[model samples]
Target: MEKQLSKKIKELVLGFQINELTEALVYERIATFVKDEKDKQTLLRIAADERCHAEVWKSYTKEAVKPKMGQVRKWTLLARIFGYTFALKKMENGEKGATKAYDEISKEIPEAKKISEDEDRHERELLQILDEERLKYVGSMVLGLSDALVEISGTLAGLTFALQNNKLIALSGLITGISATLSMGSSEYLSAKSDGEEKPFKSALYTGIAYVITVTLMILPYLLLPSSMFMVSLSIMLLTVVLIIAGFSYYVAVAKELSFKKRFIEMAGISLSVSAISFIIGILVKQFLGIDI
Candidate 1:
């Protein structure tokens, strides 16, 4: 017997069917490129489950719905660029909004509750098995990014107030940043080696790459702005520092299941504090030495 569902309920059920079908395709596509046999099998299983779910919803709708092919491409591309762990976890997080809909649908179709339970189970399994190799070096990345934000931002702030010349500040900053990048990379190498990390060279490389990228972003404002626009360049650089801190914190928070707010506040506070103190120090030093440039 076909049960009568309200128009709104039918629409919601169709939406769920579409989502399941899209995720099924996304997982299937992603599984093809996964190198690890275990991971690929896991993805295949999840994709099968999603397909089954879509079929369940389709039974209620009595009408076939097309999967969102655009979303399938977007997630697969994201997985390629950001790694499967980050992309899949991020996509799963977006599913939280569907919980209430699932609850609503469960009252009409009891099978919806089983699907919800399966989704919960899948999330738990993902958490346990999605540990990628790159995540192991997140500590090295944190070290590089945090140190660059604090040291380079402070250095740039001091130089901006003291030198008052954009080109000169950019040159000095590049020199300092390059030297610090090498030092940080070598230090990470030694530290990782001493700690018996499996791949110390890779750890150092991650650290160096993170540091150099941060340095480039921080220094680009001064290099691009006019020589007389020191204050504007300084403002833009500071904003970029805040953006970098927020972005990395959010990335780590999502990937590691950590607290985004706490991480962002801690890092931004430390970096900005150092910049402020250095800015004041620059004024003091310039005035005391009577240096005009």
Candidate 2:
């Protein structure tokens, strides 16, 4: 007796089949761009699995299906810009959602269960092999980005009202930012040395450089815009802080398999709250001290 698939089952099978083929193309495209031979080979192997999985689905559907080329291109571009690790991990995460559907479908076709298991294994192996230099120095990045968001937000927010002059605000921010960068770099080096970590110099360099770049971005509006727009400059700096937090949080979430929403909310809350408090303090200090510069 030839088993029959209903319209709903046919739709589901075709959808997953297309997804598998799309993933294969994405992996193949990324592998070509990767410089590391070992990483490239691993990606190729994953792509092979994806192709095999699609073929299995094709047997059930009994129709030749093309991949979703749009998805394949989107992921290929993402991998090129953000590194293959992040791209692959994000794809694996998407597969996790599909696993539930596979489980439901397994009742009708036992092969679906096997495919789900293979997906789980792929994710496990992918994580084991996914090694990007950016992820390696995540701690340094967190320190640099976190400190800059907090320190710069508060500094700019307070100085926005305190100084009331864009030139003075910009000058003060640059001076403070430069001094803090030096202090943070030195502290990082000393701390890494104390911990017996490899390449203390590199760690310090990464931290210091990340911090300086962030500070530069935050103070940029103040430098370029007119003095009357100091308030607007502060607003821009605050917006920069949010973007920095969101960007870093998203990268870490994808790379490390963490929660982007939770991390982002916590960081934004803490940094913004500090800025709010410091803003009030700045007003109080300016009024109490009678210092108008």
Candidate 3:
């Protein structure tokens, strides 16, 4: 019984070490790929933090028990096979799985729960790091793209209602697309710079390019159709629906705690609110100013 308990403790220690190593590697990858110099520096800091965490776990394991050479080798092999991506994926699966295994052995063995808690702390720290830097940009880009698609698409639809000709509708859409792109891109750039964060020029440039691309693609269908009001309106609505779904899916994926119904309701509410305001503005312009295309 004592021997069995000892083996279990060794396994848990090895698992914690593997998790820390995987987190370190993730930080390395993020640092390599991130365009913003500040973001890259942040990732490097996170990687150093994770390395310290791994060292602590290793020290504890060394003090806890002496495992056979074969056993140590086997665990190392397992860690390498799982790789950083797979380990992070598992961690994101939830704290429950990691805790379950830790809980089963932590009480029976000394210092096991402490190690487990350390791993949990490391996971939370990694999450906070991601939230602070990468996730914010991801959320901004997604929301920005979604907003541009729905707003500009609705604008085109309303203009089609007034224009009643495909060529005229396409021309109006082109103008709206260009105007929205410039406006959104400028807004994003200035907002990033104003936040007191070091804004890399490349990050801002890429964001501008992406904003233009997403908006242009969203409105292009309306331009390609024949000079029919019905087809143009239909195309815009379809694109809006697709954008809403895409945005909802992204929100749900990132917001794992939220139920599907709740995420859908929240995202749908925001999309509808924006669309409604844009539509009202369009109607008022067409009626009051005689801005018919």
Provide the overall lDDT of each model, using Cα atoms, as 2-decimal numbers. 0.91, 0.86, 0.59
Count of clashes, each model: 0, 0, 1
Better of 1 and 2 by TM-score: 1
The model with the greatest lDDT is 1
Q: List the residue pairs that clash in candidate 1.
A: none
> By how many angstroms RMSD does model 2 differ from the true structure?
2.7
Stretches of candidate 3 above 4 Å error? 5-21, 33-96, 107-110, 126-150, 160-168, 183-210, 223-267, 273-293
Q: lDDT by residue for model 3 over 36-98, one digit each (tens)?
A: 676467667767876776777676566333224443344334334433223343345544567
Q: Which should have the higher lDDT, number 2 or number 3?
A: 2
Models ranked on lDDT: 1, 2, 3
Lowest lDDT 10-residue stretch of candidate 3: 82-91
- The 10 consecutive residues of candidate 2 with the worst lDDT sum are 126-135
TM-score of every candidate relative to the true structure: 0.95, 0.86, 0.54
lDDT against true structure, model 3: 0.59
Tens digits of per-residue lDDT for model 1, 216-268: 99999999999999999999999999999999999889888899999999999
